[model samples]
Target: MMTQMMDILGPIMVITAIGFLLGRSSIGFETRTLSTVVILVATPALIFNTLTSLDITPETIGTMSSAALLCIAISGALGLLVLVMARSSVRSFLPPIMLPNSGNMGLPLVLLAFGPEGLQLGVAYFFVVSVVQHSVGLSIYAGGLQLATIARQPLLYSVAAVLLVTWTDMPVPNIVMVTTEMLSGMMIPAMLLLLGTSLATLKVTDLRPALLIAVSRLGLGILSAVFVIAFLDLDGLTAGVVFLLATMPTAIVNYVYAERFQHNPRQVAGSVVTSTLVTFVCLPLLVWTALGISERGSGADAQLSQAMTRTETSLGATYTND
Candidate 1:
């Protein structure tokens, strides 16, 4: 278990660690430019490529969508409850607790642990979360409902294009597919690198609030994931993918939003860093549990197949005698 865990998560950490070291060194780079490239170029290409190329069935989309929405809704509600009890601003706390680093951490982790199908499902969940983060999460910070920003994001258009192409069964040229795949390939490493850079730049002033929010994010997320999987009857790879995604830490975008809106950026930054640190503990456990479930599920399937084969053999012998 330990070896498997390290093998799966080690590469992710190594890449991020490189970025972290660079971030801390005299070496400097424009984080905004990197973020823009990721958000506008790499991410759109990745989403477009995955949505168009993967065998994303209605069942798969529906299950992943349900899990994403349910997880966010449950986490947001719990965060709101805590904020109200503590007399804290929802704007300052909820987004950090509700939103997660699905892009940076969730996507790559799922891809590594569960393969392409898992990556496809992870993207579906990520899309749902991104849409909500831009619209609903933005509104929470701005103190008003905002949908225009969501409409303006390049990702929205990319998703639309992919859906149109998929629905029409358009034959994309090999060059286009290859180009998009090449661009998409950069997203995971860039995202992890960006995560490390973001963490390095962040300064934590309010450790108490940061720790509280971090713990709440992970705790609420796990509970919500359990309910979502059970309610949706999600099993096997889908269940595991959704659960790990649910447990992802505060998104880097949350800090961006917090800084933009002046919603306690320091505290938000602290939460982002602290929650990510906690993932070093929580994520492995989630991965281990998910793999165990997959193993048991396969065993049951094999047993069922054997039973059906024995029944067919019995019936065949009876017919031959007749």
Candidate 2:
């Protein structure tokens, strides 16, 4: 189990460390340009390629999407309570608490831990989170619903195209498939590198308030995921994917939004940095727990199948004897 955990985490840490080193060095890169490319090009391609290529059922996709939504709702509710009690700025802190780093941190973790199928599910969860974050999350910061912003997201189009193809059983052009596959390859590594770079750049001001919010984010996240998983009776890869993605740290994007809107960006940045640091410490335990849930669920399924087969065989023999 330890070896498996290391196998999953080792590559992520190494790549992130390289990015952190680069961030500390004099090397220059356009963070916005790279972020735009990932969001508009590579990520959409990754989602389209993964969903279309996988033989996953629509029911499974819906379940994952629903789980994602539920996690957000629960987290938001719990976060609102905490914010109100603490008398914090809802606009500044609530977004960070409700939303998570499902893209930068989540995709790679799920892929490494659960493989391609896990990546597929992770994409689904990321898709839902992205939609909500851009829509409702943006509204909280901007003080209004940003319909234009939501409509402009490439992820929405990518998911729409996926559904169209899936429903019609249409064959995507070979060239398009090849192109998306190529673009999809770069998405995860780019995200991880960006995560490390962003972490390096962000400053944690006011450790007391920052740590309070950070702990709230992680705690509400885990509680929300647990409640949703149990309420929805999710298990196996689906449950693990939901749990990992749901429990991710406060998104770096939240700080960006806060800075853009002048909504206490410093405190938001502090939360982002501190929450990510805390999550790194807890990741091994999270991975272990997720893996255990998956294994136990799979084992239960296998046992049930065996029991049904035995029952059928016993009934057949009894009828023969009669």
Candidate 3:
């Protein structure tokens, strides 16, 4: 399982290498602009397409929602811990710490790594994380909340697009779907290119803090999974989904938020860059090691026994009459 995970991480590492090297070569100017377009237009379409394609039953929706909230809760806890440890106020420390780059980097990779299941989990991550970041993250980072900003968000567009697909069997306009797809297809590579551009701008001395941030996320992530996932009875693809999303580095949204609200945008940006780079290796490891097929815990064994008993039942009297 570990070897298989390493195989999957190889492409990610290659892509990341290209990103970093391109930036290092100072040829990433065009790539940065292309990345902006991908984030503002294409990536959202891809996410909407994936989310709408899902057959979100009430049970599945509940599970997704629950998992997302759990993730948000953990994120909040971690951010607060960091702020306190640094002797920084919650109002100044959280926005940079809480939100992760789920959209620009996480969505596309998740689709590739874990397929539809992984994509769905990414969408779930987007929903919960976005809501929490906009609300709780903003309040903490700014020392106040703003309801109007939430009320006026463009995110409703995604929700509308998703519902349009899910509730109807009608065919989508060919041109529209194709355009959306083209945009969506551009998202991953463009994001990597932009990341490359960013990396090129940083000096070696500037990267020490980034390294520390990455190690912090990875180490804390390991601890969080040890307790939360084992207690939750999630297994197989679901377990993989949870761990993959949970282990993602501080999101790019934090950078955006920091422009307006955070005390140290540089630190936030550093964390985002560092964590994302490391997650390429760490994400696959976490999924395969912590989330793959596993025996359900103690109580689950009883449930399995009951299910087997039910499966064994039959209307036939067998040969007892003989």
Candidate 4:
């Protein structure tokens, strides 16, 4: 089990480590742009496809979605508490502090490690966090968002997907499913490669603050989620996924917002790299323990867990793409 996990985790961490290195280098901007493109386009398609393609059951989706929402609520609240206690206001720092680096880095890494199961969990995380980031976090960050910013959305599409499944005897189209799957499959590795390109340009010393802030934020978020997961008695995968997503580094969307609004991009960037590096170690351990890996698990269980994990990646991609 440890060996299998190490295999999955090692490459993911290595890519990010490489990314960090590249990001500090002279070629950083060009690499960052390409990474952004992959995340904005290829990754979203992967998410949509995986989310839609899996044999999605109401119970499964419900459990996963609920976990995600719970994590977001917890993370968001924690961030606010930090802001408040530090005598900071949401207007100044809450949004960047609250939002995790879920896209570009999180999406790609989840795809490679958790497969379909990870994909599903990642999408749920994205949906809930996206909302929190835009609504509560955004309101705090921007003073107020224009109705136009809020209006541009696919809220109804998510609603219709659920309703379509509930209201009638219909199936998702095969062609659409295949197309999404193909495109989504390309999302992770491509993004990682681009991340590598980005990292090749940056130096390590300049990014220490980003790491420090990310570690602090992620540490608090994970501690909060761990308490909730224990209180709720979630399933192994559910519990692990919840903790994993909660531990996601500060997300890029917040950084962009920070950049646009004249918030501190340095803090946001530091958190992204720091949280990411920490997540690689923390997540696998959390999963191993939460999933009963040492107790309810044996060799067979690892294999079974592996299968379940794959569903998260594959189905999540479908659901997101569709």
Best by TM-score: 2
Clashes of each: 0, 0, 4, 60
| Top candidate (lDDT) | 2
Tens-digit per-residue lDDT, 215-286, candidate 2: 887778877877787788877888788878988999988888899999999989999999898788777867
- How do all models score by TM-score? 0.89, 0.91, 0.74, 0.73
lDDT, model 1: 0.81
* Candidate 3 lDDT over residue span 1-322, tens digit each: 6576666666556666687787777543576467556645765676676565555544554566576676656666875687577665455445544455566556656666677777776676666666677677766666678888766554546656665665675566777777777766776666665665666554333565555556555544544544455566665555555555665676666666665764567766776777776765445444454333233434443443342233223101211221
- Give the per-residue lDDT digits (tens) of candidate 1, residues 1-322: 7898888899999988988887898867677898899888998899889988887765666678889999999999999998899777787889888988889999989898988988998998998898788888888888888677767888888878777776688887888788989999999999988988877889888888887788788778776876787677666787778878888898888888888889998888898998888776556666775565444543344443343344335434543673
**In model 2, which regions exceed 4 Å deviation?**
298-322
Off by over 4 Å in 4: 17-40, 105-115, 134-136, 153-169, 191-212, 280-284, 290-322
Error of 1 at 102 (Å): 0.7
**Alpha-carbon runs more than 4 Å astray in model 1:** 298-322
The residue ranges of model 3 lying beyond 4 angstroms of the native Cα positions read 1-3, 28-32, 54-58, 146-153, 164-175, 202-216, 220-233, 277-284, 290-322
Candidate 1 is scored at a TM of 0.89
Error of 2 at 90 (Å): 0.5
Where does candidate 1 clash, by residue pair?
none
Considering lDDT, which of the candidate structures 1 and 3 is the better prediction for this target?
1
Per-residue lDDT tens digits for candidate 4, residues 1-322, read 8786777667766766676666666753465466555545555455456556665565666665676666666666776776677664456455555566565566655555566676676666665566566566656556776566655444425534644653454677788768767766666666565555433432233354554455555655565555556555554555555655665666655655665677665555445555555554456654454344223322344444554455345434543673
| Residue 76 local lDDT, model 1 | 93
Better lDDT candidate (2, 4) = 2
